[model samples]
Target chain A: METLFDQELVVINMGLEDFAKTLKERGTRVMHVRWQPPAQGDADLLSLLDKLK
Target chain B: MSKIDQANKEAVDKMMKSRPVWVDIGRAKDVIPGMKDNLFLHAGPPITWDRMSGPLKGAIIGGLIYEGKAKDEREAEELAASGEIEFAPCHHHNAVGPMAGVTTPSQMVFIIEDKEWGGNTFSNMNEGYGKVLRYGAYDDEVLNRLMWLDEVYASVLKEAVKLSGGMDMKSIIAQALHMGDDAHNRNRATTSLFIRTIAPFVVETEWGKKTDYDAPRLDLTNVSEYFGKNKATAAAEVLAFMHSNDLTSLNAIMAACKSMALAAHGVENSTVVTTMARNGTDFGIRVSSTGDKWFTAPANVPDGLYFSGFKSSDANRDIGDSVITETVGVGGFAMAAAPAIVNFIGGSPADAFDATNEMYEITVTENNNFNIPAMDFKGTPTGIDVRKVVEKNIVPRINTGIAHKDPGVGQVGAGIVKPPMEMFIDALKELAK
Candidate 1:
């Protein structure tokens, strides 16, 4: 059986703070994705989606 | 398969087969049996009256005032202390609520039905923004808003749903997960999708017709009014409210997740966790192997950013049943898919992805329904095992809103919380038995 320690880690970095920092300091690979609400949750933009649909 | 593997498979299969849909709105007393006049249901595990936390007490008082049992907070508190008012966990009644999470007999709850598993679950309505009753604020403004939601909002939604023949909640949730919402603290995408789906239905509902059959045929000022001129205002208000509150879909998502977890409950010899909740006083978890019994520990205060003028010291211990989102693989477990959640939950985008990656270590499998695009469309980790969690030394990571420690003070901030390891240790021991 493959154990947790034997597997490689792939990290998703929401931002470079706190928990992600600790993981990076320990030399784990991290991938960062800049996250924000879709279309900034704009009412006009959302209504536009309604139109498209 | 080994005995443990077979048990785990049985548990995961039920969870995957669950098809929860938001079917109706119901009063607690009507849909949930044993909900009497004095009974008030809260989040997390069962707790005694004296041991209740401040926000919880505040919610009970608010529930009393909302139900007309008492005129004010003082009278409400007295009624609660009189021992006539009963307190119970929402989970005990197939219901869940956020914050003080007090679900009273009169409140309207979203009723989610699981077609596959043949059960229905409920969650109390969400009060948008701060100073609402859910966080324990029970002033006139809060009461007025609750009354409006119960009287006006619920009726409009119920009619629109009936006219439009209801919707599939799982479809919206699956799309929301794809569109970058964890569906707990951040629901921008899901909120937009829900309002967009229902706006047309709401428009179909004619105002004044429900009240008067002979309601005057409007001599419209503008014939070009595409939406009924009278109903446009109501539709506008609903859309605007949903737009302003990013967490509007939270209650529905929770109801859906609860349905899935309910299906996973009561499987013999399975170590899968069915519920992870906090009642501000204690953190509790229920394992599939152990049935309804709760393994609890001292609740931990969350670590995250505090709103302006509030310090971490002012925050209450973790509270509410919002963890249902995480229990079925959305919320914090899918943080990598919703990097934007860090803005509300207080972390970096990197932290969000790291959290999701770490969760895979403890969970039994990834959920096919909730997929993360950033991770090559990998499903969010699902099926928490008491045994695996103990062996790996990892507790479930939770996304939560922080309430004030003092009653009626309302929310202070939001952040990440972890269940204590001790509860899992107790659950593992139970499984061994």
Candidate 2:
């Protein structure tokens, strides 16, 4: 816990790209994952996809 | 592995193994299968005359004029709306073209054959620069340039290509990726290599000499008069024309990519995208498993730097079959290889690297042949999987030339754009069914 806290924090920002940009502006290491809601937030499609999996 | 995963593997394997070679040049009417006398082939999926965008509509009008079916633009427009003329997608005929992608009966086309798959693809010969037919300009200047390409240019090139015995387009594409060409919007290196490879043969070409060639031939006997008396002058002029135009190899490369994509088509349950094209009005995609069925959505206008006189408002919606490059993995999927292209399409070098890096998230594999040196020789992202696209909520990116919204205005700019995500969702639903 002490080592973890002593090290720098790196974030993996998903969904919103601006979050990653803001983190980077604050001099934090950040990676922006271009993402969205699975099946574009369609309830029926998401359920169908879950069933298929 | 899951069934879809196995199928996707088979589909992408076929794509990677396929080798496209430039075999011949001939008139579209004589070479392309199912090409009818009055039929005109345009870009993208089936779009009616009413829904056709300005560039596509303008190209059709110009095609009619060049075919001598109409004497003027007014007559061509009337004939187009008269419902007598038949229009179909170029993909329907085992061919692909860039920009407006309008192909008429008399236009000469480059013939590319897939060595592994035994399928042939075709594209119309590229007209070099300003006020060209591919971008929808139809003045006498455009027609005259088309005529010159059909007669003088095609004749020498046909002989030169035959003398070189089939240029390996797949190899050239792989090399171009390393030499700073994404092989869609930026093709300076590809064009240079094309001119270098054919220059010797272009000089050796005997205009009137009859030679027995293996591929289907277009009878240029009548047009031999266009070559004139001087051999050196003809070769010099052809070289100069190719040198001046950086897009000389684009149409041929599009045909080659079409052959590559067609090889991956029709693999049982594969979700790999085989075609992604737009007709200015609608963007459409065809998956490997779905066969010929197209899922379409409204095309969005590209955002980028405009020319001196044009603004974003003047730019048309995304257009062209050139996205076939992205489908087979080198256009937008390999942007890191060509960082200089950012200057043309309006982005920083880091943005170019990010563009390519992001694509790997939605693709099935990395292309071994098209590796990027900037990213430590990492292979380019290849084979777009529809399921992955929906699952990850990411869409494929394309960098392209922006045509003017109004026809005959020519190209306004070049930029980056993505097809609407709804097309992928709909395609995924269909695949599930």
Q: Pick the candidate with the highest lDDT.
A: 2
Summarize candidate 2's per-residue lDDT along B1-433 as a digit string, tens digits: 8888898989988998999999889999999999988999999888999998899999999999999999988999999999989999999999898989999999899999888889789998888767888888998878877887887778889989999898899888888988999999899999988888888898888852433322223223323345543322455556767877899999999999999899899999899999999988999999999989999999999988888999998988988999999999899999999999989999799999989988998899988778998898998999999877888777898999999988898898999998999999898888877
Runs in model 2 deviating more than 4 A are A1-12, A27-37, A51-53, B208-232
The top-ranked prediction according to TM-score is 2
Global Cα lDDT for candidate 2:
0.87
After superposition, candidate 1 runs with Cα above 4 Å error: A1-53, B207-233
A-chain TM-score per prediction? 0.44, 0.64
Lowest-sum lDDT 10-residue window in model 1 chain B: B211-220
lDDT score for residue B422 of model 1: 86
Q: Classify candidate 2 by CAPRI docking class.
A: acceptable
Q: What is the two-chain DockQ of model 1?
A: 0.02
Q: Candidate 2, clashing residue pairs?
A: none
Clashes of each: 10, 0
